[model samples]
Target: MSEAAEKFETAMPAWKQWQEAPWGRLRYAIAEANPLRHFGERADEPLRVLDLAGGDDGDALRLAVRGHHVTIADYAPAMLTAAAGCVAAAGLTDLVSCVEADANALPADIVRGEFDVVLCHNLLQYVE
Candidate 1:
């Protein structure tokens, strides 16, 4: 594993605990918000969405609830596990799927993947 990823795994427990807390959740709040604000006219039509580093934030699952098929690509396996659990709990197995991906060196799951909407809320400054 890469040094950064390995370090993140070591800090997984604390990260998860914080992320599960209400305050942390508020940082990525979208589940209960107006989906229309983000989608505008496309809100009604079902669109394929690619959520990079989406993890277990519940954002992808919420999009699936809106009838859009969502693929959540996260670098961390544990995060994907949590996201899978949430997806299954929401009975959105068909609408939501997970893939392991690292933006630094993306795999076909992300490189060749096709989608109508791509959500990457995290600040990603492209060096190139």
Candidate 2:
């Protein structure tokens, strides 16, 4: 596996634990950093958004709840699984998709601009 993938695998447990915490500073940080508002008030149309390094924390799921079609991509399978569960729990299965792919090497289809918004949050630190 690539170094980035290895690091993500190593960090998955801590990430999960961090996300499990009750409404904390991290939650506020995520809300503050969220890009959804930038999409503006005319966000009725389901926007195709890509979330790189998106853990199982439900940030993308929150966007989906707001009527966005979201793709949650992560290098770690465990993270992707967690994201999927988050989507399911939110009853947003139709609005969210999960992919196990490294951020550095996104699928060709995505590189071709399949999404309207691409998020690379908290991922650059792990990239080689």
Candidate 3:
């Protein structure tokens, strides 16, 4: 892992806690509406989405609900665990995949252009 990846991993626990708070919920609600705003009506299609640094993956879940195939990637194991739980709870296991990966060094499959849309939000602020 890189220095930045290590810092993020160390902060994951605190970040996970905040993401369960009311303010975090509000942010998630707003993020969930973003794809529709950008993709318009076609957001509901079975498109492939790569959600990089997708902590807890709430936005990805929203996309999965719309029948999109989503891969939610984060460097934090705890975040990926939470995201996996959310995916299971939403009954979107088939539509969503949770991965522990750094955005700077993405997995080979992802580098192969497996995704139609890359959703990278609120992550660069933490990177050097």
Candidate 4:
């Protein structure tokens, strides 16, 4: 296994702790990790965005809602499931897609040079 994978395995899994957190708490902690401000006044402009290690708090949901294509990628299945649920509840299933991916080594499927923006919200801390 890669050293990054090993570090992830040895560390207390962030996804697990996130699962136990109140929805509001996690949402506030990592609120919109930069997508909004980065867009400046181009809120109406749609772009393909990849949210690396995106938790289940809908941090990037705002982007997805505003007609931007968002892929919420994470290492945790549970978080992805919750994220799917949130997107579904918001009727954004068509706008947002959730997938399981490791930040250290992403799959070729996700690595295709197709995205216009990439947001790694709260992912660096877990990456080595």
Clashes of each: 0, 0, 0, 0
Compose the digit string of candidate 3's lDDT tens values, residues 55-87: 878689888988999998888776788789989
Off by over 4 Å in 1: 30-35, 123-128
Q: Which candidate's TM-score is highest?
A: 3
Per-residue lDDT tens digits of candidate 1, residues 28-75?
565436444778888889898888777664678778887999888777
Q: TM-score, each model?
A: 0.78, 0.79, 0.83, 0.72
**Residues 45-107, model 4: lDDT tens digits:** 888888888766356577777789888887766667778888989998888988777876788
Worst 10 residues of 2 by lDDT: 23-32
What C-alpha lDDT does candidate 4 achieve relative to the native structure?
0.72
The lDDT for every candidate, in the order shown, is: 0.74, 0.74, 0.83, 0.72
What tens-digit string does per-residue lDDT give for candidate 2 at 36-118? 56777646678898888776645686678778888888877767777788788889989888877777778887678678887
Ranking by TM-score: 3, 2, 1, 4
**TM-score of model 3 relative to the true fold?**
0.83
Ranking by lDDT: 3, 1, 2, 4
Which candidate would rank higher by lDDT, 1 or 4? 1
